[model samples]
Target: MEKRLLGVIDATAFHEGLQELTLHRSPAAIPFGGRYRLIDFVLSNMVNSGIQSVAIFPKYQYRSLMDHLGSGRNWDLNRKRDGLFFFPSPRLDHPVTGVGPLDHFAANIDFFKRSEQEYTLITNACTIFNTHFFPVLEWHIASGCDITAIRKGGVSLGMYLLKTSLLRELIETRHETGYLSVRDAATDPNSPLSLCSYPYEGYAAMIDSVDTYFSASMDLFEPEVWNQLFPRERPILTKVKDEPPTRYAREAYVHNTMVANGGLIEGTVENSIIARGVKIGKGAVVRNCIIMQKSKIEENCIVEGAILDKDVKVERGAHIKASGKKPYVVRKGTVQGAWMNS
Candidate 1:
C-alpha cells in the first residue's frame, strides 16, 4: 500500500542550551553531530524509510531552517513526487489560536485530507534517533489499530503513527472544541474509538504487540491530570531500546572530531567533531561542547560545557563557564567562570 509520512518540524527551543543558539534561528536549524543540523536526523529518517512527500512546519524563526533545508536537496528529497515543502502557520483569516502539536497538525489538516496514502506517521523534529518507519506503519495496519503511537521504551522519543482517518477525526473534534491533547483523546471512552499503544519492546514483543494490540491510557500524560480522563485496566506499553549514543547539550565543548553532519550532540570535548577549517591550539582543552562551521579555538584556554557560536574566539588562559545556562563567548585573556546575560 502507498504510505506517506508527515514529519512535523516543530520549532520550539525545548532545551535551554539549544534555545540560546536558536535565538535568531529555529531550533530545527541548530547544528549537531559536528556537521549535520538537528533537523537532518528526522528528515534523513523519513528519506531512508522511502517516504517521498514531507512537509516542514516552521512556526517561528524559520529563515535558517528554510536555508538549510532548501528543497530537501541534500537528502535526495528533491523530486517531482518527493521534495521538502514548507507549511507556514495559518494566518488571521485562518485564525489558529492555541499552539500545540495537534493544533499545528490541525492547521495542516488539508494536507492529510488530500493525501492518497493509507497510513500517516507524525514525528517531532527535535528528537535524535534512527529507525525505519515503514515497519511502524506496517505494525499500525496489521494491528487493526485506529491510532498507533510510536514511543521509545526507556525515554520517550515523542513519535507516533495514526491512521489518516483517526487523525482527521481528532482534528475535527478538537477544532470544534478549541483544544486537543493526546492525553485527552486517547482516554475518552465516549469518543470515536479507543487507541492502541504499540510497545516497542524486544523483537518478539514488537511483533506480538503489533499482532495482539493493547488499549491506550492517560499514562502518556502528566499524572496529576489523569483524573480528567478515564482510566484503563492496563494501557499498552511499548519497550523501545536505547537509541544511539545521543547527547543533549546545555553547556559543552567539542573539538577536532568528525561529526556525521546532522543531529544534536551535547557535552564538551577536545580535538573532536571538528569539521573543515576548525583550529584548536595546543594548550586549549575544550570540554563538553558543540562546535559549528569554521569556528576557531585558541590556546591555553579551558572551556567547559559551553556552546561556541560560529567564529567565536577565546584567547590565551581564558577559563570560561557560564551558570545561568546560556551559551556565551570569552574574549582574549579573560578568566571567568560565570557570565552575565546581556
Candidate 2:
C-alpha cells in the first residue's frame, strides 16, 4: 500500500468557534495532547498506514505549520523519492467551505498527474484518530465504489478514499460538476458518483470548536481513550523536542494529570494536561485545565476549566474559572494578571 496510496491533507478549513486559539496560527498547527500538533494525528496515521507520499495543503497563517513540520522528518516522511510535499493556496482571499476544495487542488494539478500512486486518501487535518487506511482502500476496491467516506456512527469523519484518476477528474471538472470540494461531491444527492461509507468503529473526534476541543482534551484522561489513541504499535508521532523529565517540587501535589517533559510542578494539579516546560508556582491550584507548552501559573493562583495557550503567564494571586459552558481560553503568549481574574 505504501507505493499505491497517496495521502493528501487539507489544512485550510477554519472554524469560527476556534478563533481564540487560531488567531496567530493555522488550525492544523494548534497544540494538542500536551505535545503533538493537531495535524500530527492524521499525518502519523497516514505514515503508519504505509503511505509514504503525503502532501499538505495549507492556507492562512501557515508559518507556524511550516515551522512545526519543518521537513516532516519527525514522521519519517523526508525521503529521496516521493516524500512530504506542501502546497499553499495561490488565492488566499478566496473563501473555502469544505475539507478538500477543488480549486486548491486545481492550483497544483501537476502533482496529481505526476504521482504514481493508484489511489488517494484525502482527509482533514483536524480529526483525531488512529486508523489504518489500507483496509479502507481494500474495501473501496472490493466494493467498486468511486468514493469511500470514512464515518463513525453514521457521521462523516472528513476522510475519503478514491482513485487518483477520479480525484483528478473531480478537480478538473469541478466547475461543471458544481462541486466545490470532495465533501460537496460526496454529500450531494444529485451527483453521479457512487459514494460509500466505511464505518470505523474506533475512537475518533473531530476538533472543530472550542467545546469540542475541550471535550476531546478532557477525554484523554480516560484509560480506554488513552489506550486507543496511543497504542504501542501505532504511536502518534510529532516533532522531537529534547527536554529533561518533568521535575516535581517537594511542595507540589498532583493527581490524575498528564504532564509532559521539562516542566516544573510546585503547586497542586488535578485532571489536567500540562505541556512541556510549564511552571506551577507554590500555592497555585490548577484543575480541569489544559496548560500548554511553556505557560506559567504563579503562586496563590487558582485556575480551573481553562486552556492556557503557549507561553501564557498567570500572575500571582489570580483566579480564573470557567462558566461550565466553555473553557476560558487564554490566548497564546499573553499575560493574565490578578486584576483580570474571572
Per-candidate total of colliding backbone pairs:
31, 0
lDDT for each candidate structure: 0.53, 0.93
**Count of clashing pairs, candidate 2:** 0
- How high is each candidate's TM-score? 0.67, 0.98
RMSD of each: 12.2, 1.0
Model 1, poorest ten-residue lDDT window? 207-216
lDDT of 2 at 140: 95
- Measured by lDDT, the strongest candidate is 2
Q: What does candidate 1's lDDT look like per residue over 66-113, in tens digits? A: 877776667676778646678865542333222225666677788868
Query: Residue 109: error of model 2 in Å?
Result: 0.6
